[model samples]
Target: MTGAAAGTASRPLLGSAVAALALAALTALVASGSDLVSAFDARFRAGADRAFGASAGSWLGPDGPADAVGSALLGAGLLTALGVLLYRRRPGAALWVLVGLTVQFAAETALETLVGRPMPLPADGSAPDPGYSFPSGHAASATLILMVLLAVLRTGTRVWWSCLALGSALVAAVGVSRVLADAHHAADVAGGVLLGLVVGCAVAWRVGVRSPHLSGKETR
Candidate 1:
């Protein structure tokens, strides 16, 4: 809150803003060329083999929760409640909700339609796809879930380090499972991770700045 401490803290914010701009620019540039886009589309289409590539991938990978009622229960019932309950701090909880919403939007709407990438298919050559594939929702939601959990638990839990370790591990495992299932590409997963980290950290930083107890304690 003081002059020197504030200056030290603002550096990370400045750096992150710069980095986000850079990534946005990079993603934009990659999307501008039709020839390149066509090439990529052709590759994915050609590379996708219904009987083997896509089918094998889907089978090998972890099952997705999009169609599963149980998953919705877990996310809506357990995760949402946990996010609110664990984060007794107002700023932190609000930040987490904003981050969660952002992750969900990027995964379900913006990224999905933007990429229009198809999933690995069955032996009958039927495609299992809703829309684009530039970013994976499963990976994004999984990351957001853990990120929220960590933020919610960070200030309250005595064992903050363990919470972080467990959260990160869970996110990574879920992402790997999604990939193995042929639900998403490695690039899509990476995009999801980056999106989650940026939004989650921004919320965390803003919350930490306002938290009296975490004024100097949070390294985020």
Candidate 2:
């Protein structure tokens, strides 16, 4: 094969290998991160308890900035904004948005039921820490939201690289937020980010390869 053709053939393989490595890393982080788990639980609970001065004090405490920022990043409102932008720039990104939300929500509900882990808060509480901690639904959703936004941006190499940098930062921020809020352990958030990155990357990569404009652009 010609050099260009050979390189093209290797792209998917390299991508797949990288994807697999990320998955395994996440799995390990989730399965064997007890120190992080203890640290997240203690620090978050202490911070919340200190700030809130009660069981549920932190819900509307000084963490307002973090909550507001996290909500804007992780909420349906933000998702809607992202959807609108993607619809205008790259409609295929919309499909991934739907898919990512559906997968995370459905899996969280089903697994929480199966594992029967209780939330740290009440049933009707917005911060219910109950259900399975294996994967944090909030963190998953937040991380995905960030990735989808990044993916939907213009797809030149510069844009793609920029998205990668910003998206990674956003995902990490959300994960940390969950831990700081005492809503989830660090391992839980780590798992959430891992799952999100893999799922989001796959979906966004498909969109990129299939996008008429993006696919046609050559990277120097």
The alpha-carbon deviation from the true structure for residue 218 of candidate 1, after best TM-score superposition, in angstroms, is 10
Write the residue-wise lDDT of candidate 1 on 86-153 in tens digits: 55646446545555666567545765566455664433445655555556565556555555454444
- Who wins the lDDT comparison? 2
Whole-model lDDT values for every prediction: 0.52, 0.56
Cα lDDT tens digits, model 2, 105-206, are 776565445544344443135655434565676676766666556444554568668666766666666655565554565556665665565565555555
Worst 10 residues of 2 by lDDT: 115-124
Clashing pairs in 2: 117-131, 118-130, 119-129, 119-130, 120-129
* Model 1 residue 52 lDDT score: 29
TM-score per candidate, in order? 0.62, 0.62
RMSD of each: 6.2, 5.6
**How well does candidate 2 match the true structure in TM-score terms?**
0.62
Candidate 1 regions with alpha-carbon error over 4 angstroms: 4-99, 102-108, 121-126, 148-158, 216-220
Which sections of candidate 2 miss by over 4 Å? 1-69, 80-84, 87-89, 109-128, 146-162, 218-220
